[model samples]
Target: MTNPFTRRPGGTPGAHLPLALCAAAMAVLALAAATGLAVDGRTVLGEPVWLKPFKFALSFALYAGTLSWMIGQARRWRRTLWWLGTVAAAGFVLPEISAITFQAGRGVRSHFNFETGLDSTVFAVMGGAAYLGWLMTFAMGVFLLSQKRTLERPMAWAVPLGIAVSLAGMSVGYLMTAPTPEQAQALDAGLKLATIGAHSVGAPDAGAGMPLTGWKTGAGDLRVGHFVGLHALQALPLVAVGLRLLARRVTVLRDLTVRTALVVVVAIGYGGLTWLLVWQAQRSQPLTSPDATTLTAAATLLGAVALAAAGVLLAASRRVPARTPVAATR
Candidate 1:
């Protein structure tokens, strides 16, 4: 299908250039990162230097694309709204990716790096950009909430709720900025500190981590939660879209309220899972090896979702009437 977001004001392709351009730029960065990884054997924090850039570029590409498509669906003040969003992407968002890529080229950690003046400056820029970008996204979410929508029940909730969830996910990064025990001890001693914070909590930053992603193998890695939370931007809305597609084959999905209920259940479950990941990370537990407690929590969460889904389906079967025509749901 022709994506509406890729088009300009009158159904041509252009106007959302800031977001589209960011997506394109990220793709280029991904290519460059791939090349760098292949040619340069240098590793930072025990991982390939360009690896961070490669992961970040691909993620941002999807992030930007999703936001672009979402804002493109606006009916009221579309041009102005998208223009404002585009500007936000250009001004605040672009700097973030740029800083990461720049630090990658320098062969140093981009995050929590305050060792030197230049690294501190770059990290400061990234922090500032994060704040501004989040503020802009919140503003966009509010504006989206105010506008009337033509989407189905699931999608209608998905777009704005996805933004809300993404905001929470973005906020999760702040936890990584806090001082660890060692850093706190150094600060208490009034000694100069090179790095104030880190991604790994119980373990050191450059310790043994999972392949490719570099998530800490058996320690509290904040990145896991941050990654999971941030991607909900794509996950939640895409769930709604996937359900809509499934409706063609399953008659139970034809009821508007049923679909809405399912969306709510999934959203709640997704949010729960995000929190679970953060909780697990904070406890210094490796994601690959969740213990009994973590396993129980996860099982409980899954059970709740199943119960809720069964309730929705059962209620729909009794209340919505069997084989309700698809048109009636709308």
Candidate 2:
């Protein structure tokens, strides 16, 4: 069978490496995503188990693999490494900030194991690692696209702007984890890093029985918005790439196909923001005396919007099928 990467325009060198890495990351990410979905969906069918921790580790490895591939694909690995270092800096700093908050809450330093499953440490490290991986890859894409004569300018702006907005969301997440000034001085760095790591795996409540609560309760939940927004850097660009490849076959409609993907990504990214707002509102609802109606309503609204967006994306995808040359039709 013909290899996809090997066939890149002008038969570029080292194509095999990037393809291999992308394949590996995709395989692992798929497993993590599937496991998360199954566990979350089956929450009503059975009790959640510690075995689910595999998804967290697998997810982190996937993002790391993606970052490695992105940097390796660069024409100048040295320059890319600097950007990679920037992402790592954010990874370390965000956790330190979160640790300050986690400590301030008088919350126990939580740990995870094959026996008891995920806790705060797992959440922070996993989340931070994934963010690092994602940002580095996003920067690489921006750098690469700038060099491409066909894809300069627009992608230049979109890629960086998207990364910035996403990072802003991440910053919110880190802030949300902070507890109080009194407890900040006593924060444990190790425990905080672990929490960020666990969160790197996927979205909030992604796995079953992962009680969607943080040490700071309401504040941490709002950080889910950051996860959603920041991760879009990975999701949107990849979707656009897929869209462009698929559009290659329909010569007449290729431009339209690519534009549609961009539009859909922006719209969905915005939708994620709206969902985050709803979650923040829900998480912050006053108990007064242990009432849940407000939270329930907020969740319901987010669910409805999510469903609508999914429907629209499905419809759009139907219009632009993957590429297959006309010459091959015979």
**Alpha carbon deviation, residue 138, candidate 2 (Å):** 7.6
lDDT value for model 2: 0.43
TM-score of each model, paired residue for residue:
0.93, 0.45
Question: Per-candidate RMSD vs. true structure?
Answer: 3.2, 11.0
Position 217, candidate 1: lDDT: 89
Compared with the true structure, all predictions reach lDDT values of 0.82, 0.43
Q: After superposition, how far is residue 84 of candidate 2 from its true place, in Å?
A: 2.7
lDDT of 1 by residue, 1-330 (tens): 333345556653443557877888889989999999999999987899999999989988888877777776666656666766776687676888899989988899999999999999999999998888788878887777655355566887877777887888888889999889999999999998879888887888878899878999869888888888888889988988888788888888887778888988988888888899989989989888798999999999999999999999987787665567775433
**lDDT digits (tens) for residues 209-238 of candidate 2:** 324222123222344565466555455556
State residue 208's C-alpha deviation in candidate 1, in Å: 0.9
305 Cα displacement, candidate 1 (Å):
1.0
Using lDDT as the measure, the top candidate is: 1
Weakest lDDT window of 10 consecutive positions for candidate 2? 107-116
Top-TM-score candidate index: 1
Model 1 residue 150 distance off true place after TM-score fit, in angstroms = 2.4
